[model samples]
Target: MVLETSSTAEASIRAPADEAAAERDLARRAQRGDPSAYAQLVRGNQGRILRHLLNLTGSRDEALELSQEVFLKAWEALPSWRPEARFHTWLYRIASNVAYDLLRRRQLVSFEPLPPDHDTPAETDSPEVRLHAKQTIGQLDAALARLPPEQREIVLLREVEGLSYEELAAALAIDEGTVKSRLARGRAALAQIYTRMQT
Candidate 1:
């Protein structure tokens, strides 16, 4: 039994130890000329990346195209990848930078459609829920657009990605205090907008 247990343990180790191990394995395999690992990585992140692009760029079509481009870029850069950071965090940083670069080049990003999220409510409650949700989201989008790009990025990093202050700092290449200060200021501005919405 002891020998059997040891063999199983060794087999599991040969498989993957954990997420970090898997990340390293996938990265190495991709680096050593495995296309499937890169495909798997792209599949794992496609949805999240597209949604984030949707929010950041405000265009579903562009988001889709950019997500593809992000994967292509990732494939090209995979050999350079060092697992010094969370893979998703690194991917997101790249996507964010890509979106920013595209925006900078075009001088604007097209706005996303603002149809309400009326799908998450009970049939009876959906009307009211959607009404309020639309108003709130509309106000948020307006205020978000009005904010400077850096401020909007911070706000979305906090609220949408749910990155911690330390994580946001690392992702944005800013300080933790700056993350906190930006969050506070951004929320305050959002509050003012919501209050005006109430009035």
Candidate 2:
């Protein structure tokens, strides 16, 4: 459901050719007044949209509501989607902006878990190793909670989404230099916290 589209910026996202082509084709058809085609597009993208919302809201219930809202908004704005930008880019931009707006309005703290797909910890060679690994991950998660939302978002985009500076910039509506600086500072702060935890 990802690969085959030349417009997709994510080089690593792999999906069937027919599926990818079907998305653009459906989108193209939807633009041309095919209601069923639009439904297909929503079905194809709902999982990704939900994941984005879940990450942003840190609650499955809230994510489901927000995801529904995103699709509703997408449907309303579909006609305005410029052909120059990839469909996913347009969708993500809208979703991110909406999430930002919602967060600003709610003044809520995000309690999102460490991404489930984070790099795997090596298997423990001993009980001590297992304990240490658990302790380290817990410490990191605690430290992550202490970070500013901007810093946390940057970390998530880079580590979980695997987006580069350019993609990160676009996703966050920031400049490339800003992305680099934020990432550097975020890493430095994380290192400082981890160092403190060791003592």
Summarize candidate 1's per-residue lDDT along 86-119 as a digit string, tens digits. 5666677778888888788878744443234512
Write the residue-wise lDDT of candidate 2 on 14-40 in tens digits: 454455566778788888878898888
What does the lDDT read for residue 42 in candidate 2?
Answer: 83
Pairs of residues at least 3 apart in sequence or in different chains that clash in candidate 2: 3-15
* Top candidate by lDDT: 1
Q: What stretches of model 2 exceed 4 Å from their correct place? A: 1-23, 109-139, 194-199
Lowest summed-lDDT stretch of 10 residues in model 2? 111-120
C-alpha root-mean-square deviation, each candidate: 6.6, 6.5
lDDT per model, in order?
0.74, 0.72
lDDT of 2 at 38: 85
